[model samples]
Target: MATQAHRTKPALGEREMIVLMALLMSLQAFGIDAMLPALGQIAGEMGADGNDRQFVIGAYFLGAGAGALFPGAFADRYGRRPVLAVSLIAYIALSIACALATDYTMLLAFRLIQGFACAGLSVVPAAIVRDHVGGDRMARLMSLIMMIFLLVPILAPAVGQGILYLAGWRAIFGMMAVMGVLVGVWAWLRLPESLTEENRQDINLFPILRNMGTALTNRGAIGYVVGSALVFGSLFGFLNSSQQLIAETFDQGENFYLIFGGAVVGMVAANFTNSRIVERFGARRVGHAALLALIAISFAQLWSASQPQQPLYQFIILMSLSMASLGFIGANFSSIAMQPFYHIAGSASSAQTALRMSTGAVLGALIGSLYDGSAKPLAVSMLSCALVALAFVLFSERGKLFGRKVPSPD
Candidate 1:
């Protein structure tokens, strides 16, 4: 395996790249968050139950995971810009189809494909960053991207709620389509190809399989990937059940976006803090500490959930704290996982994200399914995911915890 040292310098400025990457990647979150306020509207119109409603979100993740498994190899073979352009085109088309769907099944299918198209946004941006930098630099850049990316969750639900107030749920999809088109046009016009000709691989199956296998076998990479997936499961579980928890369980239907945005403040602060400190602390050290914090918070949330008629404020505080810890875990864990696979960044990113999205989606759907007019299921699943993530991190470290390894990208 060879590194990307011989490639021509990236054309885009760092700030420009960060803004572009954050915008493109936010599409996935926008798709999910913006629809949150309309889940009840979707359910009522579709004549579906609570469990079925969760699939509107889960299906997209499943498609994203499934679709993500291959595009990295394609990007490695072709180039980042072309693959991204094609995916954005597909994303726009599918989002439009989603808006026009007359039934639940059609909407679900369109969303799945839309998510599949959105996979390029997930893999390519990370690969592009890996292409330009490595080690702690990569971690810092990723954290910065995440710091900006966190704004989507903070604002998207509100946007979705506003859209719902002005129009129907279908118009939300229309808005997604418009955004996808605008992004596609911007990327086509300004985004330069990040992968160099020297690093380009042929679209051959054997090497793709071999490289993927090698990435999967790397102890550090796979460990962080799985750990991140478990942690993401907690976050996704919250997203899957949040609307009901806010609207019905807490009787705060009108205040859903405000409460949700308030919780996101903790995440925003954590991401900013991680961005400032990750280079000095190392991605693994910061992530490990955050994982511990998450476990502790999860236990506190679990205990609170066990009590009868838990105060909404108490629940919000614990949830906010958990998300705060998670903000550190997510981007750092991802940067660490991608560190060892610089040569195969595309394939590695695709595989890692595929696993993470699929696992989180499944775990979240399971937790959501267990919603029984209380928050116990969400608390139980979140605690379990956090503990499992900690276990994986410990195992990956082989008993060593806070030490930072010198990055070897050969």
Candidate 2:
């Protein structure tokens, strides 16, 4: 069990800490979203064909998943600062390596390694937040963090495109390395340790493994992790195939970023609203409704896609609705998943995060590979994921659906 010796908040101011965590988490999103505009250029230069281009995104997520299981445990043993510092340095180095790649396979390899480093960014912040708070407050904090974290998606493609025009796609990667340095310096100088000395543990293989097993075996919390994976796989599928579908199927290549950003605005709004309402309505109640809404929106997307000469307006509107539903679902579901564990926060986070990423990455790559110059595949996959996710939710709730079963107090 985790020592709960330093459960009080850190020394950093709440606002500053929130913003810092926001940037740390957003770096991973920026890494993926910022490169969307350049996938075609990379493909053309390196002779990638068919759905092969999507491998660039797939490789990164796969590496992150594979590397995620270690960071949290390491942070628990060695302190968050050392683990985060090493990860940031690695992220900076790998970003440079990616920029220097000369072929498609080489670029994919670098991206895979870079993603490994970025896993620290994903696991540590959530663990750190969990170190101090839990339940609905954690959910509200996560919603705010997500509100800021998600801004990367809204603006990244445009930033990448601007760099692609002004300097080159490779320059976008250079910017990423520079940003990593800036964030690293900020963290090193200002961010105090969230895991205090008393809570630090010795590196023991058995305890670590046991804690991971405990977290993964939780009947209620672990169910949400699987459901979250399935739902997020749909989002990942959209990311993997987004550029191609937006540019080709919709005949909006030139306005790709604008249209994409506009749709993501719905997500931003939903998250902001979720932050306001989740504490009042409870996580499960709100998230379950949003999950159902996502399923409905996906069905509407299928119907829209089947119609001849469907207007881009219709498609974007339906997609925006789906994205909005995801906004409500993400924060609330994660909070519910994390609600059951406090003492094993780091190990639990590590195990669950690794599972979600690995499963989502594989499923997303498969969905992307099914692209055939149309939106049909994406719509079908999303609806299927939603249905499966709902089943997991039902299993988690013991066939119940709505109302909050609050975890025992921290």
Candidate 3:
């Protein structure tokens, strides 16, 4: 079992710590979303046929899922700082490789490596929070981190678009390479090693796998994780299709990214609200309610898409609402699932992140394959995934879906 230690002094100010953590975590999202604007350029350059272009994004998530499992154990064994340094350096190198890729296969390969390098950035900050805070405070801290994370989806595409206009798609990856290097240096200099020697676990695959097994065996944990994954899958389906949907359905070509950025505004607002409400309402209650809202909005989107007078504005409004609800669901579900596994937080986080990313990749792939120059596939997939997530949450909570006591982080 992992033991806790109280420090004589606070490590960092809450706002500064949360902001830095947010910057680290947001890199994963930036690497994925920021490139959306350049997908067409990349496709044309590499002769990518149809939806096969999505493999570029899907491969990153696949690598990230696989990558998340090892870093936590390494952090627990060596230290968070060292593991983070190595991961960031890998990310920098891979980003440069991605920028220089001459073919689709090479780009995809480097994206996978870049995704793997992001694992430490995503997992380590949360572990550091666990190393310091507990229970409701940890949940709040996570909510704060997520609020900052919410900014990536809001700004990354715009950044990518600006780069596209100035220098071209290649510059986006070049910028990412620079960002990785800077963040790595910042981490090496500023971030302390949160995992002390006494708290370190035996660094082995078997023990880590065993801890993952324990987390998987917990009904509530599994339900929350799976439910979160499905919800995330629904979002990923939309993300995978958004550029095409905007271009084809709305006849907005180069301006598609601008509209996508507009949709993310709703998500940022929702996350900011979630930061305030999560403590008072509890993660489960807020998550369950948000899932219901997501389902309803998705259904509305499906109905709207089925109509003859289906306007792009209608689709935009419904999608905005759906995305907004996602902000509420993401962090809450993760915190609820991780609450019970304080002793094995690293393995638990690895399992949950793996499940979420793998589910997103599969669902995104399915959505990408079904692209038919319309919004139907995207709407159908979103509604279906939302319904499935709602069902899982209902079953996981044994029909007590709202107002339940927040489980203490044990």
Q: Who wins the lDDT comparison?
A: 2
TM-score of each: 0.96, 0.96, 0.95
Candidate closer to the true structure by TM-score (higher is better), 2 or 3: 2
Q: Report the C-alpha lDDT of model 2 over 1-410, residue by residue, as the tens digit.
A: 12223435666887787789999988888889889888888889899997888998999999998888989898888767777888888888998999999988899999998888779898889888888778887888888888898899999999988999998889989988998999988887777777877666667999999988988888888778999899889889999999999999988877888888877878888889988987788888889999999999999999988877778998889888988999988888888888776767778788889988998999999999999888889999999999999999999899999977454364
lDDT of each: 0.84, 0.86, 0.79
Give the per-residue lDDT of model 3 (tens digit) for 255-284: 876789787777777878888877788887
Off by over 4 Å in 2: 1-8, 405-410
Model 1 residue 152 CA deviation (Å) reads 0.7
Candidate 3 clash total?
0
List runs of model 3 lying over 4 Å from the truth: 1-10, 407-410
The runs of at least 3 residues in candidate 1 whose Cα sits more than 4 Å from the true structure, single-residue gaps closed, are 1-7, 405-410
Task: Return the clash pairs for model 2, or none.
Answer: none
lDDT (10s digit) by residue, model 1, range 309-348: 9889988999999889989988888888888887788988
RMSD of 3: 2.8
